[model samples]
Target: MQQTCVIGAALASCLAAGTALAQDDATLAAVEARGVLACGVNAGLAGFATVDSNGVWSGFEVEFCRALAAAILGDPALVDFHALPADGRYRELVSDDVDVIARGGAWSIGPDVRRGLDLAAVSYFDQTGFLLPVELGVSSPKELDGARICLVDDMATGPALDDYFHAAGIAWQPVAATGDSEARSLYLAGDCDAYARPAAELSAVRATFETPLAHVIVSDGSSRVPSGPVVREGDDSWANVVRWTFNALLAGEELGITSANVREMAATPSSNPEVNRLLGTEGEIGAMLGLPQDWAVDALAAGGNYGEIFERNIGENTPIGLARGLNALWAKGGLQYAAPFR
Candidate 1:
């Protein structure tokens, strides 16, 4: 009787382990069966992700989605873009409505690590600041005493700005708007003395305003914000899939490889083993991610490298006309660095 009981217990334990393994496989398979990756994006952030006249999506965030699609399904077009409002982003992601949220999310301990979500990678680094007329003569954000500042309702920016103002001993009027666009209009139309937003966003909006000389970004030393991708908590598999996609682009750029030149470089194998591994002349890294062996190639082919994507979307010739100040490749003295593929 004792021997029979021991055999039965061992059998049950083995069965439980098998069940857990099967459940994990089933979850991943279910996601793949959906055919398209649903990505949550900001409703309308110009340089980030926004729908256009013909209802086509384009922008920096859109490219990230496209790249993920290409890496996973070998088709860059296999993405369903969900333009979720800022207030709804968390709900949408937490409810399993989307696979990932590609919005311009800043990493914070409270919302990122503590709120049951994982931040993938910092794709675009930004700073928080205010845009006011040059006439305000406010060289520092601390000088905006009793000045009305426009901020979007239900966003972290308000609290952050308020904290800054409070600490600096400045009493600023808080004017809340329904959305960022509305807040921008309110400030640009002279409804408020200044408008506060992420620095990159301010640059994008400034390009659209007719009165370029009318606005100036208030330089506050405390607005440095890191923007990245996010996935649901405990989903390490999916998180790695998204994180390394951004890293791959940075890696490609640092290695002096571009989409235009990848094909030619692939043919004549490099003596550089690391380049060979990255170009997939030597490793099954993509297969390990449940993608084709040349997945990174497809990602680069869809866009270019990290530098190309930046230049095409927000660089000097683009409407945003942003200079690569802190975003330059590491070798070029910028902060963009990636782990070795090997």
Candidate 2:
């Protein structure tokens, strides 16, 4: 039989005639049975994931895990954070070391669907960028000709940087670093003229510098990457739960229901039916997902909505000081609107 592609807004990949896309819920069962959510996160990237001196895990990745736990187990603190290494995170996920691995590069064919893992959703829209001294007077990436650049080894940005500079006929000296922290250390020690990494991470790293005002980040559209949570394939049920957890965060933000106001909002069902349905006072949305009606309330309470999470952890007011450029809600002209709860 000849195969035909059925691509559309609904279907992302081509389905074969005899392919069986199973919806196993073993991961979900294990998570519930074990009474905790085991989530994989980066070992120690400032804005994304970090373990503080108090043995508390906190950051964007941390909040996602906690929210997932809140949805599944009814408590945000019922989480086991497994700090996975950069090169070994996928292997750990494949081995079932954690229920889900958060904070991957982007949604791509090989790393996601083709590799037997599903990208639940794009949690954050991040782009790779360059951090250089202000004195360099370089406002754009194309201006970095013959400059020593430090980049973390084995990142997608390598090929991207190569293509960007090669096409522009720009030459740059490459300084090797093992990871983001090393790149920051080397850049701070003046081992290289610039350090390259994701713009959010660059902002977080730069904020820790003694002379933060002396540095600047150069971002380009070509380096944009869609980063989010990754789960093993063949489990659409579990993936749906993960995706909706993110949606609830976004929905909370879009509906003006923040962590501070979520309890009040849930306690009193206002004129908005969607808000009532989301908070579990009106509809069976949680029951449909095999969760309690108050699941969203717990998730929202774990952290604030998406906007609150960004602002608290890495927004312009925070130490990381990243602006909500493309992360704002769709109603506000950003690309972060959620699908309907119904």
Candidate 3:
């Protein structure tokens, strides 16, 4: 009887181990078999994720997805973009409807600790602020006490707004909208006194207005908004691929590897050990991640470096025209610093 019990216990333990191993590599195996990276993006937020007149998607987040595809599939075009509503992003990831969420979603304690999701990395550092029509002549968010504010219904901003108002001992009404477009519409139509969103997105929203100069982003009541890609929990391999892809973007910028110069640098190895390892000249870092040695090269080729992606999408020349306040490289006095490639 004792021998039979031991055998049965061993069998059950082995089965449990096998199940855990399968769960770990499930996402990566599915992505490989599908031959495409499934990326979730915002429906239509200019400068972050938007479709052009020709139905081509292009933006900072879009470029990240393309880079990820390039790294994994060796082709930047092998990406299936899903336009997801803000509230449904987490559900989509959990349900396996999308592999990764690259929308500009703020990382908060609820999603990270409570929900079975992981915010991989901070792609863009932003702050939450209020946008008001200049006609109101409101210089500060505090001046709008008891006012109606347009906010996204399902986001960290909802709770953040509530906390801010409660702490300030102010009364306000929330005019919830399904998405940024709806929020902007309500704000523009005078349904709300102000529109609350990330300052970067507020600029994008304002650009769509007929008279962009008529609106102003309030400088008060701001909170840190660190947005990034999100993936389902318990898949460290898949998460690493997404996280390191973002790091490669930042590392490429720091190493001065641009789309225009990556080919040349790859062909001719440099004396810099970090640059060589990053470009697949020295180490097997890519192989460690189950990718080709030239994975970073493909990523950089897809969207240029991180800096180039920003400059092309939302830099001073673009309508959004955001300066690299906290998004710049750490060496250049910004917060964007990547882990060592080694």
In candidate 1, residue 76 scores what lDDT?
Answer: 82
**Candidate 3: which stretches are off by over 4 Å?**
1-13
Per-residue lDDT over 1-342 for candidate 3, one digit per residue giving the tens place of the 0 to 100 score: 133323687888877776777888888789889999999988777788888788789888899999999998899999898888765567788899889998547788888888889988999888888999898899877787999999988888888888888888889999999877788889989999999888888888888889999999985636788989999888988889999999999998888899999979998999999899889999898988888899999999998998999999989899988999888888888899999888
Local distance difference test, candidate 2: 0.84
- Candidates ranked, most accurate by lDDT first: 3, 2, 1
Question: Against the true structure, whose lDDT is highest?
Answer: 3
TM-score quality measure for candidate 3: 0.94
Q: Compared to the true structure, candidate 2 yields what TM-score?
A: 0.88
Write down the lDDT of every candidate, Cα atoms only.
0.78, 0.84, 0.87
Question: What digit string (tens of lDDT, one per residue) describes model 1 on residues 287-337?
Answer: 777667787878877787889888888888887777887788777777779
Query: Number of the top candidate by TM-score?
Result: 3
Clashing pairs in 3: none
